[model samples]
Target chain A: MKVVVDGMGGDNAPYAIVEGAVQAQKEYGIEIVITGPEDLIQKELDKYDYDKSKISILHASEVIGTNEHPAMAIRRKKDSSINKALNLVKNGEADAIISAGSTGAFLTGATLIIGRIKGVLRPALAPIMPGKNGPFMLIDCGANVDCKPKNLEQFALMGKAYFETVMQVNNPSVGLINIGSEEEKGNELTKEAHKLLKEAPINFAGNVEPRDIPLGNVNVLVCDGFVGNTVLKTIEGVAGNIFSVLKEEIYSSFKTKIGGMLLKSVFSKFKKDYDYKEYGGAGFLGVKSICVKAHGSSDAKALKNAIRQAKVFYDNRVIETITEYIENSIADNDENIKAE
Target chain B: MKVVVDGMGGDNAPYAIVEGAVQAQKEYGIEIVITGPEDLIQKELDKYDYDKSKISILHASEVIGTNEHPAMAIRRKKDSSINKALNLVKNGEADAIISAGSTGAFLTGATLIIGRIKGVLRPALAPIMPGKNGPFMLIDCGANVDCKPKNLEQFALMGKAYFETVMQVNNPSVGLINIGSEEEKGNELTKEAHKLLKEAPINFAGNVEPRDIPLGNVNVLVCDGFVGNTVLKTIEGVAGNIFSVLKEEIYSSFKTKIGGMLLKSVFSKFKKDYDYKEYGGAGFLGVKSICVKAHGSSDAKALKNAIRQAKVFYDNRVIETITEYIENSIADNDENIKAE
Candidate 1:
């Protein structure tokens, strides 16, 4: 299997990207194609020793910055690293593509360039976040801002498919995120989506409130992008705030400072549980191929893990499974609509 | 000024509620009317060493539960403590009402009985949560399941009025909670609300992403109830999960257990900062009369603080200010529409 890596993306750019790609090639034994300015990528590649034949470089002169309009930049900057890497996947030169760049640009480039799966309304940005028991999937995290009930129902299905196939969970539970867990609760979109999700062919776990998300009661949590983004960011904000508070409190006195020293490893482990690097990257499900968007500040370890995540997603044929399931469900719904 | 207290509300009920009322009367020198079974309220009041003349009992035989339908229950159970308390405010027997009862029932009773301020489309549940710098208000948290652009615009105005009056923040910054900060970002409702808020007479901070909420960048965060509720609950969930995780980690080893003991005070101080009692209760803004809903599990301290909050709200004439602001804005819009 082959994977295309964006070599000039993210904060750590060429160094972390080149090193991660080399590690993935050596450990996973996958053919790797790094896309960027060839000279820049080569300079970083020279710092690491690896199998030469297993990795190749593709030159792309332009780059997409964080401030640019995502869709417009993707269309205009065809020679950008993200676009070149996507082209490799489109032309069957690679089975999957990974980038740790501007999330908006990567999402736009992947959707418009790689295209959507048949019968899919819109692709979802599915990120796996740490929960009490384990990690759970949050689907449609800032992909389609305004979504109809149908979009959320499909997000539940796509999320379910991704969880079961890639995470290898059996009959993963799917939940519709809402203000309340009662059937009649939530906004119009969630109320309608709840009804549709109950009838979808998956392990529907009723409505899940945001308070219960961290408890890991459900494997797949589905919502429109606006609500999903709010939940995701709030979780992040709270964790960060708590850590900052802890850092200050832990140094307030001599006794507390000594206590903090003794519990240093404990805090480290706790922080690791909530780290984004541990999960690698978020997957853009309902697309034609495997596409993963890593965190913009991802280090070498995170990028390497993202490449592994992409390879696993490709190996499991997740895209084909989602396509088949969604097509069948759409057809069934169409027939039901006709009869009604 | 007189404040009505729901003695038969919340988990702690007559004991905590009655004691809180007695404490408020003693500290603030405000007349307190407790609503519940006369005999039950009197028994709790007798346990407290306080002046009898400052406290009075209004008989309420029934209690609305968390499971009951809010609007329907409020209409049917006329003698319920929540309904009677709201009736006191509506009847001009009390300047404000404080309840730790079912949030849904309290919101329903307040809107149906006390009514909305003239020209206000909907009342909002605005809660003050602890942030890094201090506390910021989150408006419309589970009050209205769905909201239009106009409703959010009004929420922003109401939130601004509350923060400036009760919190005494001068020209408090108001932010429209959205997935992104860009002008074109967010769903249709927020996109339109953004435009309306920009033109509204307030310190509009444009779009504030959820991540910035904990950083206390804005004094007031406004969103549709669904998104607001999700953000509120997610922050609670994250804090709870982190504490649970920390408990496990701190007890994971003998050395860490010793560390935990030494650092207990630091942890306690940190927890106190985020405690619900510190901020009193949530304000039901845009109503004709002041209505404050404390946490359901509030103890005496929280309930007492909630009463103090109601008194401050009443003293500042917050209701009158909001009424005047909303009425003027509505008139200006109607005139603008006529000209167009």
Candidate 2:
């Protein structure tokens, strides 16, 4: 399989992107097409010794900034790295696209260029968050802020399909992220979504609370993007705050400093377990082609992990599976709505 | 001011509740009315040295369990401690009511008995969370699951009034908790609420992200209950998960164990700062009478803190202030809506 990588994306840009692509091509035996200014990408590539056969670069003049409006940038900058990389997948030159750039830009580009799967309302961002037992997929992390009940039902189907095919979680239990675990315990959107999910064809776990997320109670937790973004950001903020406070306390006294020194490795392990790099990137689901978004601050290892994840997505044909599942499921619902 | 305490409520019931009331009377010079089986409350109160003239008990025959449906329990269990305590406020016998019991039951009882402020659409659960600097109030934590934009605007006014009068923060700023810090960065409810908050007579601080919560960016953060509950739970879950993981790592080796002993006090201070006990309880704002919901697992210290919080609220006439503020602000909005 081949993956097109946005070489000018993320904080560590062309260096990390080029190095990650080289490492992925060498280890995973996947062909990679890196898009960026040719000179910058080539300069970084010279530091690594790898098979020249599997690696290639596609030069692009413009770069879509992290701060720009997504749809505007995608519409105006046709030759930008993100747009060009997405075009490679649209043209069947690559199996998937990976970018650690602006999430909005990437999603907009993917939807406009590659297009959405047949009958998909809105493409959702599904990021695999590390939990106690393992990892669970959180759909619509920041993709669609306002979602209808039908959208949430579709998200559950898409998330389940991706989890089953890519992560190999068999018949993954799908849970709606709600304020309470009881079926009748949420806002109107969730209340309606809950009923829809219960009747849908999937392993529908009842409403799951945000508190149960760290315990890994469900394989696929679904919610509208606003709630999902708050949950995701709160988790990130709390984890970061706790560690910073711990670091300050560890340096407070001589005894604590000694203890910190002794437990350095343990602390590192714990931090690594919570790091976004360990989980790679969030997948932009519902698009016709596969698109994965690495974190904006991703390093070489994170970029490599994202590439590996994209390969797994490509090899398992998860996008095709989701499109077929949603097409079938939504069609029945459409007919039911029509009959009523 | 006299505060009604549910003597038969919470996990450490009768003991923690009675003890906390006794402590509050002795320390804050506040009169307390303890409701339950009088003999059981007396037995617990005997363990502490407190002013007999300041503390009194009201006899009640039944108790509301944690697992019962809130509305049904309120209707059926009229002789319960929660019902009797709420009746004290209804009969003008106490200034405020505090319960370390089931939140749903407390809310149901308060709304059904004491009623809402005349112009207020719904009461909001506002908890003062301990942030990096001081404390910030998170409104609508779990009161009304579904809310209108007008309800949120009223919540912000209620929250602002309480923050200024009770918490004594000068010109406390109210911020709309959103996915982003931009004006147009939320769903329909928030987008409308933002405009309302901006126009209302309060210190509207614009939009705030969940990640900025720990840094104490705003005095009062307003949202519908679903989003508020998720943010609160995410904070609680992340804090608990981090500590549990740290505990496992701290005991992994002998050096770490020795280091843990040295850092024990430092860790305790950090934990204490983040503990729910320090923040006392969540106040049900927009109600005609003050109602505070202490955590279900509250101990003596937590219950005592809650009693102290109720005293602060009573002394400042926060409930009355909020009632007046919201009555004026929402009446204007209601007129505008009617005109349209």
Best by DockQ: 1
Candidate 1's C-alpha runs over 4 A off are A334-340, B334-340
Residue range A35-145, candidate 2, lDDT tens digits = 988888888989999777888889998899977888999999989999889999999999999999888899989999999999899999999998877889899898999
What DockQ, between 0 and 1, does each candidate earn?
A: 0.84, 0.72
RMSD per candidate (Å) reads 1.6, 2.5
How high is the lDDT of residue A78 in model 2? 87
**Candidate 2 lDDT, B193-222, residue by residue in tens:** 999888888888899888888777689999
Q: Output the worst ten-in-a-row residue range by lDDT, candidate 2 chain A.
A: A236-245
Residue A6 displacement in candidate 2 (angstroms): 1.8
TM-scores of all models?
Answer: 0.97, 0.94
